[model samples]
Every structure is written in C-alpha cells, then in structure tokens.
Target chain A: MSEALVDALNPALFWEYRQVLLRGLAFNAYVFFSAATVALIVGLAAALLRVNRAWPFRWIGTLHVEVFRNAPDYIMVIWVHFVLPLLLGKLIGQRVEFSPFASAVIALGFVYSGYFAETFRAGIQSIPQGHLDAGRACGMAESTILWRIILPQVVRRMLPEAVNQFVSLFKATTIVSLIAVPDLMYQVSMVTQQEMRPLPLYTGAAVTYFAVIYVVAGSVRGLSERWRNKIYA
Target chain B: MDAIPAIRVVDLRKNFGALEVLRGVSFDVHRGSVVSMIGASGSGKSTLLRCINRLETPSAGEVFIDGEPMGGPVTANGERKERPLSDINRMRRDLGMVFQQFNLWPHMTVIGNVIEAPLRVRRMKRKAAIALAEECLARVHLSEKGTEYPARLSGGQMQRVAIARALAMQPKAMLFDEPTSSLDPELTDEVLTVMRELAADGTTMIVVTHEMAFARDASDRVLFLHNGQIEEEGPPDQVFGAPKSERCRQFLSKKLQ
Candidate 1:
C-alpha cells in the first residue's frame, strides 16, 4: 500500500512529459478564448433581442436561450462535431467537415451564450427608466443612449455574474478532449496509456486543473472587485 | 417679450389605457418667464411637464417650442402623425428637463454626466465640451466635484449635478419635474436657492413643485392643476394669496401646513 501510494504521489512521470502537456494546456486556453469571444458577442445580441419592443424579437431570444441553456454541454460538443457537418453538407450541396477545434469552440460558445444572455438581460432591465429618460431628454438618440448610458452601467452591474459564467466556460473546455482536441485531459490520458500508470497521471491532471482554475479565477475576481470599488467609490 | 413664446401647449391630453391623466390641458410659457405648476399627487402636473418635452407622448394636442411644433403635425382627422425620430430629438435639444430623482448616471463622474450630451449629440470638440461642462458645474457650485461619482454625493449635490448636466446643453427653456420632492428639508433649501438664482437670472423655467414658498416667491406666474386640468392660474401673488378655486385653496392649506 505504501509503494502504491508513493507511485501515485510521484511527480517525476508527470514532469517527464511537460512539453506535450504544456502544449495541450495551451490548446485549452485557445479554445476558451475563442469560445468566450463568440459567447459574449452572441449573448449581447440575444439579450438586446429579448428586451426589444417588438414581440417577434423577444420570442426569438426566448427560444435561443431555452434551447441552448437546456442542452447538455457534452452532447452539444459531440453533435456539433458529428451531426452539424452532415447537415451543413446536405444544405449546401457539398461536403462539409469541421475541425475538432472549431466544433468544440462553436458548441461551447453557443451553450454558454444562453447564460450570458440572461445575465445581460437582467443587468439591462435593472437600470432605472429615469436614466433612459434623462438620456432622451438630453437629445441623445436611442442608439447613443444604448451605447453610452445603458451598456456602461450594464457591464459594471453584470461583471460578477459574467465572471462566474467565464469560469464555468473555462472548466467546460476540458470536455473538448472527447472530440480529440488534445487539451490537458486528453494529453494526460494518452500519457497514462503509454506509461501504463493511471494513478499518478490522472492525479496530476486533476491537480493541474484545480491549481490553474483556482489562480485564474481568483485573480480575475480580485481585479474586477477592485475596479468596481474604484468606480463606485 | 419675443413674438414666439418659449413653449406652447395646445389642449394636451394623455391617457393610459382607460384612465385619463391629463385632459385637454393648455398653457404657454413665454421666454424668460418663470411658471410654477403646483398640485397634489396624481393631479397630472408632472404629466403636463413630461408632455412638453414629449417624454410621455401626449395622446392628443400639440407642443410648440419657439414656434416649432413637437413630434408631428396633426392630420385632418385630429390624429397626430409621427415625425421622424431625428426631428423629435432635435426639438428636445431646446428643452432641458430635471427630474425628482436626480437620475444622474451613476457610473460616470459629475463632469462626464454633464458633458456627455454636448460631446455626443452636439458633436462638440473635446476641449470645448469640457470647458462648457466646467462652466456649467461652476454655475451649480459643483466645480470641485467634477471628478466624483454620483454615489459619493449627497442627494442635494446629486440634484445639482443633474441641473448642471441639463444646463450644459444651453437649452432655450428648462423643465423641473418635482425637483425637490425627493430631498430632505435642509437639502431642499440648497436646491431651491440654486433654482431661485436661475429664476433671478431670467432663465425660462416651468417648475412643477410642492414648495409653496418657491411657487409664491420665485415664479412670475403660478398654475394649479386638479383632475388633469388647470384649476387656477394667475400672478403668483393672486394665486397664492387669494386662489379662486376651492380645490386649490384646500390643496394649499394642506401642503403649506
């Protein structure tokens, strides 16, 4: 039992494949950034649609939020990787194949955008009508009021909620390994297969993810809190 | 006085569903004249002030600013046509409105709130906008608070900042919608002093207020609204000293007590 525990705790094997494992972590970051960008842009659009005066736009936004928010992340990734390409190919009258990276990004991005849309919508609605009235009374156009007055306040109010969504998005990037994107978990499994030592490799992968998520999330939360305090002060 | 009044309201009526808030109310505010609108809660004084700026669209009737019609022209059937949004925005620029809630944008500094309109809507140069903002802030005695956010200021200070914000547009007339209703007595005095100074400077103002002292002392004329119509209107002295309407007298006795 002591020998087995020593083997499981050993860092030597995990360190030996540092280059490949580091590269895999970098891929996770790439996927996270790409998906986060998509989610933010699309989410804002959806939120605006949800709050629109017209009924059709509100219905479309509601549909988008319900469909994506309720869908499982793993199933979405698989569906985007496998089924979406076939559908696209048939519609376009040509063959279409998505790279694993593209599928992972698109699937995760769309799924997370639903949450972000709700967050943004809540933030937008929380603003007092008087603020909009003040803007309009000053002769500001509707678009100008949205950009200058509405969005700034919404962004600030939504920051903490958005950060939680972002952290969840970062963790969700690990599921990309199922589609062969070679993220950290994927590399760890490959290394475990080669070395035939499941204990240390899987343990190391879990610890690495824990440390990275903890530090990144902590720093981001701290920085945002400081910034918010300064503005509100 | 100029041939064109600063503001003209013709039979303005507003209805929310089945309930009528304002019923065929009409009045005129000449340039450089101070008109005070006084009423009990839900008497539609605020609604009348909001209609003049098209904030709450008048269900019927017309608002004219400096001889130019607001919103759209009326068709033969008495329905008001909708004007282009840009035209309405341009017309709104001539009127500066201050609200009971202050409604200063919380994220921006005092000066940022003041200069946002001139910089964006008027497309003024950055330096020119800042200069205008500073001058307006000075007029409200908040020149030192330019860099401070609204959350840090007292209610009185925040309302003053709101006043400076409106003043930066250099409007032809200013509208006050219960500007002191939200303030404490001490805070109310500070705001009223600034408003009194504006009145003394000959700023065209339509103030909807419950401060009878301000209505009596600061106004060239006073109007009392009751049940969506002007119940009484005359010189401040006559309106306050010997109001013709029994409703106006009752309202005054209750408020002034």
Candidate 2:
C-alpha cells in the first residue's frame, strides 16, 4: 500500500513495452478460444462414442479419455511441439516443423478434450431415458434425437462445468510459452530480463491473466442468467 | 367393424433378460375405435402398447400398421429375419405415443415440442408446421401456453403439451401409456378430458390406464390384463359389468374399491 512501492513498480514502466504484452495476450486469447472450441467438439464426439451401442466405439472413447486425461498436459504439449513434426516428416519424406500456435492448440485441445468428454458424458447420462423414448415416439431418427433432444439439454446441464473447462483451457495456454510460443508469459519474461523489473512485469502479466479469466467468468454468468429460469437445470 | 385394423399385434411376446413382460399377447385396434387396456401394475399393459410400435422389440410375433408389417423380425416357419433400423423409424412415424411422464423436451417451448417431429422427420415447411402446431395446441386447449417451456407448465399442462406434440405428427393411431398415472386426481381429470375429446374425434387410440371410469366410458372395448396376458376382453359394459374370468373379477374388484 506504500506510495514508494507503488511508484517503484510504476505503470509508466509498462507503457513502452505495452505492444509486446498486448500482442502476446492477443495470441494467448486466440490460442485459448480456438483450442477450447476444438476441445468442445472433440469432447462431444468422444462422449457420443462412449455412449454408442457398439463396444468398439465405446472402447475407443474410453481409451481416449483415459490416456489424454491421465497424461500430463505440458508433456503432451512438448510431444506435439517437438516430436509430432518428426513423425509427420518421416511419413511424408521431408523435414516438417509445426508453428508453435498450431502445436499449442492441438496439444491443449487434446488435453482438455478428455476432461470435456467426461463432463459431457455425465451430462448426457443425467438426462432421463424417458426423454429419448419421447423422441423415438415422435419418430425422430437416432441422429436427430441426439442433436435436437440430447445435446442441447446436455449443454444446459453442463454449462457450469463447461465454463470451468474454458477457464482451465485458458490457463493451460501458459504452457505453450515453454515451447517458444511468444504468449503473454513469454513477453513478461522478456520484459523482466531486459529491464530487471521482475516485480512490475510479473504483476502486469498476472493482472492480464486475471482480466482474461474475469471476462470468461462474467460472460458465463450473463449467459446462464438468461437460461437459468427457463431451462430445467 | 370388419375393416383393416389400424394396429394389429399378432402373438406378441417380450422378455427383459429373464423377465417375460408380455407373453404371446394379441390384439387388433380397429380404425376410429378407442381400445383401453386396464390391468395391475406388473400385468404388461404398458409393455403391450410399447410392443405395437417396436419400442420394446417382441421376442416373438409381428405387428401390422395399416396392413403393413412393422419392424419385428420377419418369421417364416419359426425362422427369423432381422429388420433394419430405418424401417422401424419409418413405421414409428405413423404411430404417436404419449408417455405417463409427459417427456416434452425441457429446453424447447411447448410449440417447439409440437412442431419438431413434423419439421424434422416429415421435413415440413416452417410456416405449415407452425400452423399445424398451433392447431394441435388448440386441440389440447393449450394454445396460450405454446410459447412457454415445459418446465414452466403444471403436470396436467405438460401432459397436454405432450398430447399436442403427438397430434402434430398427424399419426394414424395414438398410443397412451398410463397417460394420467403420474398426475394427481385434479390434474388427472384435465388429461382425461383431453383424451375423451380425442377419442370422440374418432382418433384410433389404444390407451393403458388405471382409471376404470375412463376405460368404461371413453373406450369401445376394454382388455383386462393379468400376469402378462389378456385375462379378459370384451365390450367395456361386459368386461366391467359382467366379468367372466375369476382373475378379471378379482382384479376389477380391487381396482373398483
């Protein structure tokens, strides 16, 4: 709370380096949003596979969720960033390198997709069997029942957990910085090293993350408010 | 009436693992006639209705919808041939089934539930689907509640919305499975009133109910099921007033009291 401490960690110190941090934050946002969207779709697919009548598909889904969920996320990111290109290149007979953004998105998308698969499966199971029977009686095909009757209601039931997944995914973006992705943390480290102002730089980075998380939580709150009264949550 | 039956179940049987729910049940629902099946809780009344639409695939026997064979295994001399899922879905479209729980899609409005089938399965135009939905809602006396979600409705209103959803399909026959069992007496009356109106409109219907009065008054013929078989069946007057079987007599006595 002291003025000197506040002045020492001056806001002016950040102004010159603002562009680097802003760009990094924007990249982080892009990575998080794209990866989270992919994770949601992949997760729904995995959940469906688990609930599929065929045993083979169910085993595939189970294996996917167990493997990705149990593996450490940073290690997976490293594998995607460092090892996959080599494998791909060997297959294609060329030296292939993935841009860090694509690598990060794929890695985090896979990691979070496992969590999302469980969430989605639980939500789907919570829906009464009678609901599906009603759809069947209405003469809806299985795919139609899934899209119209099942998934929408599942989303309603899983909104809170889904928001949590997004937040987790957003935080997970920090791991990409380890792979030379010039995200917010990378920029913060660069600023701190050059200026020797670790306190101000790290605090600014923390504040940026806080702001991103706050926005996500706020948006979810707003969206759920509209549906809370009407939906059978 | 010696016309083609709207729904005909020939020697239908269903088993859940070791539990045989419906055993060699047979019935014909003549067009424009309301047939009510009354029975004890475990007497296979609901199972019989479900078998008609292949909701519960029969272990043996065939169902005919307007003279067309439904999705049971085609048996010739005790040899069975499997039916495709597409065939079952197609056959199911002509059969509208209302459940005891009124399983309307909670995420959609009452009108959305009503219009969904016609729009998706039949690929009806939006304008025409909406009009038909409104008409069906009107028939259920739920025109004003169409835009509201099912979660907002009373038990009776929810069941009415369910009936409207089925009616919107414009099915040849409607199946009711203990449609009022979950409702309180007052709400039960509301649903029964709508069902009575549907029956009067000559909608071919097979209702499974505990309401003896509804079975007697609304239905032309009543089947009393006991131990997974039709213990007695006749004109409601004969079945209710002059039951010949001992099991039917005991069952009716317990229900009436």
Badly placed stretches (over 4 Å) of model 1 are A231-233, B74-80
Clashing pairs in 2: none
| Per-residue C-alpha lDDT of model 1 across residues B33-111, encoded as one tens digit per residue | 9999999899999989998988898898889998888968778998767988898899999899999999999989999
TM-score of chain A of each: 0.97, 0.93
Q: Give per-model TM-scores.
A: 0.97, 0.96
Please estimate how well model 2 matches the true structure, expressed as its whole-model Cα lDDT. 0.90
What is the Cα-based lDDT of residue A125 in candidate 1? 99
Q: Lowest summed-lDDT stretch of 10 residues in model 1 chain B?
A: B71-80
Query: Please, what are the lDDT tens digits per residue for candidate 2 over residues A89-119?
Result: 9999999999988999999999899999999
Docking tier of model 2: it is medium
> Tens-digit lDDT track for model 1 on A102-179?
999999999999999999999999999999999999999999999999999898889999988998999999999999
Note each model's CA RMSD in angstroms.
1.5, 1.8
Instruction: Point to the candidate with the largest DockQ.
Output: 1
* lDDT for position A4 in model 2: 83
Question: Each candidate's chain B TM-score?
Answer: 0.97, 0.96
